[model samples]
Target: MRREFKLPDVGEGLTEAEIVRWLVKPGDQVKVKQNVVEIETAKSIVELPIPWDGVVAALMADEGQTVDVGLPIIAVDTAEPGVPAGGAAGTAVGTAAGAAPGEAIKALADDMVPRPPAEGAVEPGAHGSPAPKEERQAVLVGYGVKTGATKRRPRKAPAPPAAAPAAPAIPAAPVANPSRVEVTAHPVPARVAVLAKPPVRKLAKDLGVDLAAVTGTGPEGSITREDVRAAAEIVAQPEPRPARVAAPAGAEERVPVKGVRRMTAQAMVGSAFTAPHVTEFLQVDVTETMNAVARLRAMPDFADVKVSPLLLVARAVVTAARRHPMINSSWDEEAQEIVVKHYVNLGIAAATPRGLVVPNVKNAHELSLPELARSLGELAETARAGRTQPAEMAGGTITITNVGVFGVDAGTPILNPGEAAILAFGQVRDMPWVVGGELAVRKVTTLALSFDHRIVDGELGSLFLRDVGAMLEDPLRMLAWS
Candidate 1:
């Protein structure tokens, strides 16, 4: 018995996923719930598990190929060990035990000889096959007679034209024993496997470039797109110009957008166009907030977690959102109303190798200061490692993008889709400030808040920004507000 495990919807309503790698190869025995493959969807990378215990028969999809949900990616055979499927072993054993010598020899010859297909027969995936390549039926291994299909071989040169008619050749004498047979052995030419990804291979095929002849410049000598394109250009030239210099490897490159980067691009474009954005900036003296962070770091409660200015900044935002709930709400166009969220799923935008992923802390408004700091630390660590899940990114009511880490002053950031407001925290530095009518150097930072004008008007946006700045300027304000 054989069973197929299709690619399931690992993420919420994901339609497709790219196979990143195969953990289990053909002939490997796998148990139920054992991870077999890792795949990357639009949101994140996830590992998939097999559903039944069996030996892997085949890998239906190639790595780097994006497969649709519910399509079988692997086949597993459930038959017992040492027993071939379809009673092939039983037949072979029975033939060797009771069959006559001639009959047994005949059976062995039939198995060894390559037989041509019947007239009008078409091989799978060949022209005039019963079904198209995408809809072809999958066959189990070791179940029936083998097909004549084989791996691709180099094309042979055309034979010379036939000569004019001549005298008939004499026949050779037959062997003394009729059952005796003589077979000639032919050496097969070894083919070197091309080292190129699926996309690069496709590009070479489309450009009519032979990968075997082209030199690979990619890591580990894998062929890249630029190498294929260069080969194609060389072939396209009418004549080789020895004086012509070849272009540098890094002169041009193309990257395919597919995973998290693609999703971020689409979301940013949609949010930028759909939401009418209104930004407000305010420069605040955060000397007191810096002092408070230093104090919290020494305390026993905060000894285990990291204490940074961003932690206080997150706390301030939560406090301000509680005062002005409208800033944390989203505008529902279909409902034609402002949807205010009572709980804040505060999102922190982290720049990862993949892209900008905003994995938020759920119910941030309800967490204490120390709990919020720990959550922020965990979220940052998870995003940096590229392990943030899809669910962790969803349901964000408000977001804070800490541009301060990059040593930037401020930025008018676009809002995350479905969220009404996004706050930008700038770098803190010692600047001239007028405290009690005296100019003195103090730690100051800028805060830029961009919100949807449809729900949060100018007054509400300003109030929210001012409240957050005030809480940061005087950390005691958070105690009073709470």
Candidate 2:
């Protein structure tokens, strides 16, 4: 018995993923929980395994196709048919996440027919011209499409054989007699004939437009959409953007959407739309934090780790979140509940080719300052190196994005979806400050915190921001408060 597998929604809010590659093709034997393909999600590459052991029967979807979650990509011939049809196999096949979605995503497959050696190049798949129906295989099972109306789909046709193709043209009867009297027979097309290629002719026929009667603007006086849509119901399509680099005359190029690039695009779009975000900014005098960082560099325990302004800011945000637990939660719309987390899985936002991924350090509150600095270094390295895995990027409780590394002061930021708040840390620079009634240099930085308005109210938001700022302004406050 063959069971088709559709792409599953691997995460809570994902709608789609790009299939990067197929590890197994038709006729290969696979085992349950053995990888069949790798799918690239927005943040990481995940390998999808076969749900049951069987011979690989069919693969639907071509490589590089972007499919909506729950669409099938492959079919597994699970043992024998009398076994009650994989009765225990259920829907668990669609929900597991373990491998990176890789190179080419699965899409509709193309089957081949026996061809003579003299024929030219064959097209890749089903999207190509139609061949004889009998040459095709049994319908593919894993794609999300239901088994209905596939007969309506047209396959591109092979060109007619040259030896027996040409037909005699039928001549139209004369429209005017020799006496100059109008003797109508079959009406002649308008004096200016609409000259168009076969595709344009097909378009005109489908739209119920007469090529003979419409005005032509195309070269060779061909009629177009403005000539068609203006004449009928046909709408012109916008041309796609040109490729960045021109392809070599006949070389095929494959784009791999796996790894960091895919992951980043997914996170940005999720962060942008789901949460109703409101970002508030506060500039702080962080002269004390700078001194503390310098003092920490002098310490024996902290000597190895690279210290930056973000190190102190991370500690401050975590300290402040502890003081304000409401800022560390998700707004559950369906349940109508506000979830407050008792533990902190602090997400540090890292920008990579995969976009903005906040792979958090789990149980950050459990780590000491030197430990936190080490975790931050490892997190940055893992992120920059494009090796952060699926589990690390998932389940972030609260997030902090350091836009300061880019040299910008501050701006509004959106909250990562599900999390109640996200903080943006800006660059610390020397600025004028009043100290003991005298103008002096101070280490200054800006803080921007965006929260889900539905979860963190204005008072709570202000207090969270104020405490984080207070801690940064006086690093000693973190020790005192802890």
Best lDDT among the predictions, by candidate number = 1
Model 1: residue 90 alpha-carbon error in angstroms: 19
Candidate 1 lDDT, 232-299, residue by residue in tens? 99899958767857679899777889889998998999999999999999999999999999999999
TM-score for all models, in order of appearance: 0.66, 0.56
- What do the candidate models score in CA lDDT, each in turn? 0.80, 0.71
Which residue ranges in model 2 land beyond 4 Å of their true spot?
Answer: 1-38, 47-275
* Residue-wise C-alpha lDDT for candidate 2, range 390-411, written one tens digit per residue: 6887788888888888998997
In candidate 1, the residue pairs with backbone N, CA or C atoms under 3 Å apart (3 or more residues apart, or in different chains) clash, namely none
Look at candidate 2 and tell me the lDDT of residue 251: 89
After superposition, candidate 1 runs with Cα above 4 Å error = 79-247
